[model samples]
Target: MKKNILNIQGVSEISKAKQSEINGGAGWGFGGIDLSKCGCDCAGRVTGPLYCQNYFGCLQVYTCNDSQES
Candidate 1:
């Protein structure tokens, strides 16, 4: 018997409005962890700050600053 494997990859550009929502927009919306705090130039970097882990569990931020160990 033989098994087959599939490899797939693609890129899609997102508008600023959408990115804002994903990055956690302000107000009563589901948005937190400002990417700016990470001090990373996502546009110039190949891999931007993708995710982070803190005492509150995994979070979506450019960087994780949970210095104090829990």
Candidate 2:
């Protein structure tokens, strides 16, 4: 079970787009998380503000690649 952690905090839009590309290329689509499959329970979204009183929050995505054993 290999884990990939994606941080969408202060990165540029291009970087974020690249992340989406990587996920989509891997067959995860725009939603990214595919919890329907076995061993995909680790896939989820994490979100929180960067600071107090801030409206915008960053996101962190947790995904698993079970194709290869760890």
Name the top lDDT candidate: 1
The local distance difference test score of model 1 is 0.40
Among all windows of 10 consecutive residues in model 1, the one with the lowest summed lDDT is: 51-60
After superposition, the stretches of candidate 1 with alpha carbons farther than 4 Å from their true spots are 1-8, 24-70
Tens digit of per-residue lDDT, candidate 2, span 1-70: 1122234455434567677776332332444333333221343433332221132222345556758677
Error of 1 at 66 (Å): 27
Estimated TM-score for each candidate = 0.21, 0.15
Q: What is residue 52's positional error in candidate 1, in angstroms?
A: 12
Q: List the residue pairs that clash in candidate 2.
A: none
Candidate 2, poorest ten consecutive residues by summed lDDT: 49-58
Steric collisions counted per model? 1, 0
Tell me the whole-model lDDT of each prediction, alpha carbons only: 0.40, 0.37
